[model samples]
Target: MTTSVPPADRRVPEAVHRRRWAILGVLMLSLLIVVLDNSILNVAIKTISTPAPTGLGATQSELEWAINAYTLVFAGLLFTAGLLGDRLGRKKVLLAGLAVFGIGSALAAESGSPVQLIVFRAVMGLGAAFVMPATLAVLMNVFERDEQPKAIGIWAGGVGLAIAIGPITGGILLDHFWWGSVFLINVPIVLLALVLMFWLVPDSRDPNPGRVDAVGVVLSVIGLVLLVYGIIKGGQLADFTDVKVLATIAAGLVVLAGFVVFEKRSDHPSIDVTYFKNKVFSAAIAAIALVFFALMGVTFFSVFYTQSVRGYSPLQTGLLMLPLAAAQIIFAPRARLVVDRFGNRATCTAGLLIIAAMLAAFAVLDTDTPIWLLEVIFFLMGTGMAHIMTPTSVVIMQALPREKAGSASALSNTFRQVGGALGIAVLGSVLSTAYRSGIEDKLSSVPAGLRHTAGESIEATLGVAAKLGPQGKALVGPANDAFLHAMHVTALCGAGVALVGAVVVAVFLPGRTPDAQEGKEEADLVPVAEH
Candidate 1:
């Protein structure tokens, strides 16, 4: 066996090191901006409501689609984007992605209608598909094996920070400016990222990359979009009998199965199916998906609950989320150390359980529940999320060979994106169904006119109520109460799902040596021991 130096000793050349970290900063910033935009619009929902433009009226599915469309497209195209990055250059694809994302955001800000916003959001998602995987692959290139875990930890921490702070930042902007301000905010950040990337980021591509499978891309995208659509509408449609939903879901599955067959037969595959054979990689990917599934669900519900149920203003709702951001920031560095010491299995399970418990606790909350209680749950969720999120990427990438790092990272991210998409689709559907049913029941005794309005979405209810002044406000109290109850039910469902995820981790996570890539290096240093 050949002797291998430690990653520190095999450091990147000094000239490259300086330039590399600078590029890393730019890349991370761009990624942070992408993540931050995901939930920043949540708090702005109420702010966007005007007498005319209004909130999503009788369009709960449309609103959920608006929120999830970006993630859906992102998840659908991630593998394709990564392969493209390998075929072309990472920097080239990344810059192109930023430009597309910036243009999409500008269009979203200028959107005159809900359909316009949703379409632009999908455009943004398509751009993010390119940006996210390229960022991860580029980071893998920049950092050596021993350095990778730390670097990944930092990157994950940045993502958590972005998620935590996004709503609050959006709220602040919404309070000071128009609701469109949230979308407009992306322009400056993306511009800066584009400029810095051009100046500092180096370009690299695989010398002999495999062919791009256009058929696979088409199949995967169609399957994912249909799957997401089915899930988003599942609650409204009869779970068993809705032909549209059932057909769409069935079509998605068939397409996905076909896509798998195509990949197995293709001379050049988008994802190396062999990666799933590794126990560490598989477990890590599963954990990553579960964690994100819970994370997205909670974040989505929290903003709606805080602003809609608690009578908090958009800015107030954002301010309420401060503790979550604070906890993540404070515990980020320590979370990595804990993961390293305890190993991934224990730390990851603990984190998921904590999140599940927090979600369960939120379920029991009423509109009268104190802010202190909310803060406590938010803190636990944030800390737990920080712990859970940091190590999965490290473990997954470390489990793979160096040559496969780019593909592996892209696949892991695909799982994460899938989790987020499912969370929004599933949980949003549940919430919408419950909220609508509750409104119908609550408004049953009201005047026929108001009852018809109650049959509409909460957005329309709020809009009509707003025009009625104090009497209108009083009239809508029961509807608001019902909505809060529905939110509580949504929280319970999320908690149960998270608990299932916790069980998944405990049962499936392999108790293997940590940081296998580093372990491989260590093995190269010593002679083989006698059996």
Candidate 2:
């Protein structure tokens, strides 16, 4: 196999360089809104599942769709959007994405039904697809090679900022306004991001962009939709063995396999699969995927644990998550220091192991567990993630030529989203199945017609019980018990996934290289920001 050297390092243009930090602020604002919408929705899941007037009266399965819909569309279209950002101007695409995202947010805020909400969320996803990858691509273009790691750390920290802001904002809005207010909040932020983008951010693109790979894009979307749908379907039914579920999942795998073959032959592939040939690059990518895979699954359940089981208000639940966000904010930018000391393999491996331990700690939690203990777990998990994400992102982003930054960013994020989507699907299925089994016997006391629905989820059971007046009070205890049991099972599974990621990093990700060790000595003398 022939090896090719990476392109020469890019120099930041004098004009762009002068106001780089200002441009970063605009980029972060754009990104925060996209991430905020999702994190905000997590707190609203319980609210949206309530009957009409207060919410859209969505089922547990429907609620999952509401989330997975955005993730699915966003993940499927990310690569294409990245390629577009490369071919077209990044600034032009970024502006369009903000506009579309704003429009989608408005529609979502006014959605009268769950189906409308799901469709609108997908619309939001389309806009976000363009926004996310473009931000990193633009960052890559504007920052110097030596300074890239620090800038990316700040960028990753912005995700932590979004995580901190989203749920609290959603909670405050929910306390005062209708459920739709959570979505409406995005509009103002989107507007601000657009205005600033026009003023501050500069346009950049690949000099020699390729033709759009329409066929490959189509196959990827189809394959992902099919796979996720099957997993979700199995969860809803609590039966993975069903012919429909197995058939849908199998078809999805087949189509994805076909996608790989087709991309290999194409002159201008949307995703260059050959990048995986670099073991370090592949390991870094896999580390990102698994990190999100574990975290997303745990996050999916944590909201319910705090709000439904522990009986906290939306605001309190959001507050409880602060430690998690705080940890990320504190450690993300500083993670490079840890890498300098221990190398990527050690730092990332330790991070993943910390993540695994924290995930497993969920097994010890119950309704009466000390709230402070939960906070500690959240803080630790965030710390681990910060260290892993910053280093791995630097590795992945620097792997290719700077011109391919959009595609590189897209590839990194595509796996992250896909991992998160599958985490929700697979671990969600585990939770659903376990909850159903644990609650099945207790559900018999319900009206025969409602037994299946009551067994669907803790939320559905509680909603049904609320309708039963005084008779409904009896079901609350059983529902909480079943949910806790399911959570334990799911958390253990997430921990296992994290552990696997740690092993991957240990095996394939490199230790300290002589070049990096020398670079660290110089980086110590001059802070990255000064560059």
Candidate 3:
């Protein structure tokens, strides 16, 4: 006897099934723009901060704001944006997001001042907050259970692709065009996504949408913004003992604790706190965060190592980074097959361990280290990242109910952004402090005025060297050596963080047999009553 399929089981239509791949292409295209925006600004920072017709002459703090503005707004609003997508409709939210992002990009391209650029970047972040979660939510709705792992793998790989390509693309544009070209480049991509989404994507929303949790929204936004602000400030100061920094951080933590208490008591909560109770789900989140923490920290330092210390051109540095990107692209799609053959526990644990080893290897690097050896380490690091990222994302999504896809996606992406921000702040502080001390030790013979400039930063040191003629030539070697020393110190710390993350995964992440995972998926697929 044949069993009848319930209406809930029939939620996804045959047309959606046939067009699913096309839908994924459009979704990934949208994702690419958002992810690319995250890293593309890094290459353009120097160009934008230069004086006159070609640039804006932004101060160091203003330059930092230009970069941080986007991330801060993006992180602060992600959960709220996710909830809106779930309640209002994912496709509609995505379309609106694209339009807003496009507008923001155009305005940023025309920005006349650093303040204007920061404001425009924040607007783009608002748009990204809407676009990001909707992409994964739509993907979850369109793809069947069996196809999700592969699709998620491809989606995750887009992030790696963006990281690889953003610098190259930005470098090329900066070489031939104005600094604004970087922001303007996003316009065409956003427009293309908008048109395709309108034609191909279907609107999907939660059947039993909760009332807008105004209190929860306010609390989450305030808490996240304050927390990120404190972290950024703390990193900038590199002084945890500063009263202002301590007060800001303590305030943020207290408010976040209140947010948690409020969430638990709410009848119609914005996010279900119960998801964290699942060991696998929580472990997956932690792994993703820690991996990104290491990845971002390394990437930040490597850019300086390649460009400032080694003196590679932006385009050349981009080319040098190719191994990392290539490995991620190659391995990300294959991760699903590996997970199917092995298990999540083994795959994730091994990946983190490999990353830790690669990071430790980086700690020993010096000015004399072979370029090829660095490339090999990057390739291995990318491989480790792909293995961890794709599988963890798949497991996290699979563990969640379909109705919670928007929130879950936002939560995952939030962790990633937070980890990246913290990595840049914390690791950057470590690098800066070590480099400053080393530079001071070496600058004792230099003039006091020049010595201060040299100790300000590697860039400032190089600038001082350029002005000092023969004495400048003498300083270059010492400056590069100091920077390299700092890079090594930071790498050692990153390796320790990765090792700790591996231990967490080994202990908390569950091993899954194929039968067990299938059973869990079936259980998660139970039909809910239509609203």
Best by lDDT: 2
- Candidate 3 weakest lDDT stretch, 10 residues: 1-10
lDDT of 2 by residue, 1-531 (tens): 000112446577899999888898898888889888988998898889888888888876788778888998898887778778878888999999999999999999999999999999999999999998788778767777666667766776677778998889888999899999998898988988899999889998877656888899899989988998898888888899999999999999999999999999998887889988888889998998888887678778898899889988888888888888899889877888888778888999999999999999999999999999999999999999888987886666445554444456567778888888888888888888889989989876689998888888888899889988899899999999999999999899899989988999999987765776547644432121100
Worst 10 residues of 1 by lDDT: 522-531
Q: List the residue pairs that clash in candidate 1.
A: none
Ranking by TM-score: 2, 1, 3
Per-residue alpha-carbon lDDT of candidate 3 for residues 330-377, written as tens digits (9 for 90 to 100) = 887788678877878889999999999998897777776778988999
Screening candidate 2 with a backbone cut-off below 3 angstroms (N, C-alpha, C), the clashing residue pairs are none
Which pairs of residues clash in candidate 3, taking residues 3 or more apart in a chain or in different chains? none
Can you give the TM-score per candidate against the true fold?
A: 0.87, 0.91, 0.85
Candidate 1 Cα misplacement greater than 4 A, ranges: 1-16, 48-58, 140-155, 237-240, 277-280, 339-342, 398-402, 444-453, 467-471, 512-531
Model 2 ranges with Cα > 4 A deviation: 1-20, 140-153, 397-406, 515-531
Candidate 1 vs candidate 2, TM-score winner: 2
Q: What is the lDDT of residue 322 in candidate 2?
A: 87
Better of 2 and 3 by lDDT: 2
